[model samples]
Target: MIPAGSGGRNRPIEHASFYAALPLIDDFERLSDTANFTALPEDWLIGVSDIEGSTAEIAKGRYKAVNMVGAAVISAQMNAMDGQPFPFVFGGDGATFAIWPEQARAAADAMRAVQRWALDEYGITLRAALVPVRDIRAAGLRIAVARYRVSDGVDYAMFHGGGASWAEQALKDGIYGFDPAPSGVRPDLTGLSCRWAPQSARNDMILSLVVVPVPGASARLYAQVAAEIVTLAQTLDRGGHPVPRDGPAMQWPPEGVALEARAQRRSGTLLRQRAGILFQTFMAWLLTRTGWTVGGFDARRYNRAVAGNSDFRKWDDGLKMTLDCDNETSKRIEALLAHYHDRGILRYGLHRQDSAIMTCIVPSIMRNDHIHFVDGAAGGYTAAATAMKVQG
Candidate 1:
């Protein structure tokens, strides 16, 4: 059982709607402001999941599969929680989420199910850990959360303090880790899809970035750096959104059809699932090509929402973004980061590619609020994170 408090600190009053109760900040730049964050209840648990050896997987050109597995963690947990609002952030190689202790069993089942599914479907190992917020506090780190409203109907969680990063390290170091479920366990990955084709960079390049303050660096310094970087990115077209306003182009056979088939294969055989996916995608492609609305489903409107709902920028203990920009803009952003790196203020990594990909969790296409996670096509956050480690 997880403790309610640690180190003589009083347990926080439990708010059933703790996450929903926090005010939403509309401005992305304001994320750097620590004042906007709320301390999570000590009894809440932080769950971290990541693809083991994700960097090597990216080198093998399996980035799409890598991304699919990461997004699966969120989709499974959300389905398990029955859409009750909670907070989660999607990293290209994995994801992190927080949950109340009451939901621990469901969250754990979902995590184990995803771990097994990833291995069974794609030969990938997903490492997961559920660490208590009290444990994080005991380690002298904090878990502060803020909600950033991306659109009228969608808000992504932004994490502050180093607890999240610490949880990931602990998972990697074999602490607080758990084993995958027995064979044949399947996560309820309803609505997880990767049907859209990769969006080619409209500008000269698609840049993937990871910027984190060095250990013991003051929060004020990190916030100033983050704000400056956000400002620089804002100067780009559509704020460096890789997807076009109309959404990504739809090819007849999407590059992710097979992966989506695997995700949808809960009850049906793989062959049946693949065939169904093929037929459905065929209709979607035709509708998108013809610009038609059938059964109250507008392909154009859905596509527009896809563009607007993409998680192209977010903060998770640090700043992470996938931007489409010209060469000069990329150079300028890097130079600024290099100046800070030279001064030992931070550590950063960047990867440039020609296009970006979107992995989605669409509960309902008619809802106009489905979310899409974006990452650089060749090597997104996983590669950038590896580069950051290499610089040390």
Candidate 2:
């Protein structure tokens, strides 16, 4: 959910202009229809953050930390906007956000903050980069975008074309790195958390996948693959959505986790980190139990909102999903994907794990909404991405 304005009148002037300048689609159903998306403005800026060596980190049993840091990049940028509207998509290992030219500085600062946080707190390198939209176009690539209305006060951006991918590659190639914030300059990681236990595989396995159309692939073919994924999700996963939405409920004296390492704030010291965890644990109990009203906070309603805002399957330049299905179903899906891959229609990566992990951001859940992001617990998007690279 977008935060409320940083201030009534002091909110950045570019906020309104940037959102007003774009074309938005209110219908989520139409997102699958390729005709609905439009080319992004040439004057905008594309910013991205991806954790280097994410697969290794996941292998080290730090998947939760990886997921948390990845989501933190998006959360940090959203907070920087101070309630302004922008287009962003969460990747399993990082996030990509687009901003108006006027907001580039703020966006850059936010990225730097997240980069510093990732390195200092998680001991992972978060590489962030920003490139001009025009430069991308000059390289013969485009950023196509559309907005999907999920629920009241919740909207997500869908991206098409290969521009975002190209930009990410540039970052990886050391062509677009941003100057990070000063040492100890932490990003506002206030809303990040991982409160739920890992979700067990429903039938046999949870498949972490990334499917990208081959270079020069026709839009019609890509759309066909996209539609097929939706059909498979419905036909296989008991129609419960490819991404499940089971999180901690609003119970009193909420269950506390033995380890809070994955959900600590990055702005504080060791003592403060422990204190922050205790405070959040206590707050979870107090807020959900007593139903205490503070700053328009309502734990019960927030819990409901959390369940509603699950982002299990996301679309950016390609499709990324954490699907819950048995072995047979997964094989069938893979066969279809392989059929397409062999035809040079698309490239894909598939990895299986026994559970799914979630990271969340609940900023005033009563006001806006709470969103939970899920990925396969072991390997997940990172491993899937690795497999996809090898396939390519």
Candidate 3:
């Protein structure tokens, strides 16, 4: 969610103007409709960040930390821009975003800060890069973007044209990238947190899926496949939202308390940050458990907002989703994906787990617009991606 007043009103009109001018698409299914996406300006830059060995980290039961660091990239850039509007998509282990030329320096600095923080705090190496849209075009690709409004004051970006995927590949190939800052450096991870316990799957399984068209596949075929999957998911409750209607269960001394403390450590000593987070979360746990409202913060309303504003599904040059469904529905999705995979129309990956995890950026608890990112508690997109690579 773009923070209010951070729409670049004080900057040059050209800065982030393209994303700001586009009309928000209310239906998630329309994300597959090519008519809704607008080509991004050639001068804009795409920033990508990911942990170097995310799969290994997840295997070590550190998926929460991996998700936190991935979301930190978006958080840092948002804070750096002072909450200005931009288009970004959060992958389970990484994130991709676009910014105009005027914000490149700030974006780069923020990226560097996150890189350092990830290494120092979690011993994870974060790879980051900034690729120009013109360079993407030079490589025979384009970046097209559309905003999908998930709730009031909350919109998640849907990407098409494959530019984001190419930029990520370029980053991995050691092109157009930068190194991490020295030890002790940290980004402004002001609102990043993973407070709620993992949401157990009510439907027997939490399925993480990623589907992408092959290099020569027709766009029509890909869109048809994506639309069909979206339709299939719609048959389930709340389109397969993993979190319950009231929200995921809250626990005292949250699972990610240490991570949350690290995120806020810039404000004071680590111990102090940890203590502060503990106090705040304890209060939240007590309030949510008792269904109480205190001075603009309605526990029940905020919980519902958390579930409503989550990013369970998104398009980033391809379709990705974390769904809660029974084994039968999961089989139907796999069958559909397999039918197309055999014909070379698309390739896909699916991973199943008992629960899903959420990482949030709450600019203010009193505001219902806070955004949450969801992924399967076990491996999520990183494992799905690995499985996809094996398909080839």
RMSD for all candidates, in order, please.
4.7, 3.4, 1.2
TM-score winner between candidates 1 and 3: 3
The C-alpha stretches of model 3 lying farther than 4 A from their native spots are 6-10
lDDT for model 3, on a 0 to 1 scale?
0.90
> Tens digit of lDDT per residue, candidate 2, span 1-392?
35335442354455445554455565443566768777887888888888899888887988878888889888888778766767888888898888877677888888998888778767889999888889899999878887765556576777888899999999999999976688878787667776666777768888888998888887788778777876777676444343434334333222223224434544445667666666776786677677786777676667656655677776788888777887777887899999999988899999998887777776754565667777888888889989999988
TM-score for each model: 0.95, 0.87, 0.98
lDDT of the candidates, in the order given = 0.88, 0.74, 0.90
Residues 160-184 of candidate 3 have per-residue lDDT tens digits of 9989999999999898788997777
Arrange candidates by lDDT, highest first: which order? 3, 1, 2
Q: Which candidate has the highest TM-score of all?
A: 3
Candidate 1 local lDDT, 1-392, one digit each (tens): 01012221221335446886788898999999989999998989999998998988988999999999999999998887765678899999999999988788989999999999999989999999899999999999989999888777688999989999999999999998878999989999999999988899889999999999998777788789889989999999989989899888789788898999999997868889988988988988888889888999988888888888889999899999999988998999999999999888899999999999999999888885588999999989988988899997
Return the lDDT, model 3, position 26: 90
* Model 3 clashing residue pairs (backbone): 6-84
Once fitted onto the true fold, the runs of candidate 2 whose alpha carbons sit more than 4 angstroms away are: 1-29, 237-268, 282-300
The weakest ten consecutive residues by lDDT in model 1 span 1-10
Model 2 clash tally, residue pairs: 0
